[model samples]
Target: MTRQELRHKLQQVRRNLPAEQQLAAAFQVADKLEQRLESFVPQETTVAVYKSFAGELPTSPIIERLWQLGFKTVLPVLHPFAKGHLLFLSYTSKTPMTINKYGIEEPELNAQNVMPLSEVQVLLMPLVGFDHQGNRLGMGGGYYDRTLAQWHNGNRPNLSPIGLSYNEQQVESIPVESWDIPLPEIITPAKHWRF
Candidate 1:
């Protein structure tokens, strides 16, 4: 199936899941996140992750776990002036939030809370679909693709972007565009995939 076709199908599958199942999956994902990430990241490392929406894998539990483990966590905010880009902002349970154009909850823009991509150790990228090779299919706007274009081009290799996917979202292959950046790793509820 085409990327769009796959997106429609997988999105339906996720939305159809019972509320209890979604909760269970989120817990499993959070547990797995702690196990996989704690071994590699340093104490001062900061993580960039998105706020889950539209039946995407839940991220709140993982965010809480990261905080408990003493890792700084940030959420993406649509750049106020830069079109088609994102800026990572410090996110905490107490951080003030507002709905963006996409209707996704994001931290209210604050200059003092901004964290540059170069300083971020890992980005827990959200995707509609992914392949074992780490190819990702996003919501078609290419916000992340554009934001990480420099990193994809090897300009600043320090920024690492990895996907957070559920087991059912995996496809055999993801039709990728020339500018698409394939993930180096992806973490799911059941297992972690490294490309």
Candidate 2:
């Protein structure tokens, strides 16, 4: 299937999941991540994650657990002047919130709170779909594509981009673009896929 067609299909399945199942899956995902994340990231390392939207795997529980476990967390903000790019900002329970133009929730942008992607150890990203090869199908705006281009090109060695999705989002193949950025690891409620 084409990229857009596959995205719509997988997203529909995600939205159709029962609320109870969604909650259960979210919890299970948080547990699995918590168990594995510490082995790679050290104490107080900053993890960049997104605020879940639509039928994307819920990340609120995971964010709370991150704080409880003493890991600093960050969220992506739409870059004001840089179109099709993202900026990572410090995120906390008390961080001021705002809705971006795309209607995604993000911590309000503040220059002082902005973090260079180099400093973030792990980035937990949301996706429409992913494949076993770590190819990610995103929402198609290319925000992450532009932001991660450097890392994908072998510039950011310290940066680890991880996709967070539901098991249902996994597919046999994902249409990839030259500019597409593939993830190194992805975690679902069922298990982790390392590429």
lDDT of 2 by residue, 1-195 (tens): 889899899999999999888888888888988887767644658899889899989888888888888898899999999877899999988999999998999988899999988888888888899988999998999988886887877778877788888899999999888888788899899998888
Clashing pairs in 2: none
Model 1 lDDT per residue over 1-195, tens place = 777888888899888878788778888988877777766554778989888999988888878888888888889999999998999999888999999999999999999999988889888888888888889988888899987787878876887777888888888898888988888888888888889
Off by over 4 Å in 1: 40-42
lDDT of 1: 0.85
Worst window of 10 by summed lDDT in candidate 2: 35-44
Count steric clashes of candidate 2: 0
Model 2 misplacement above 4 A: 40-42
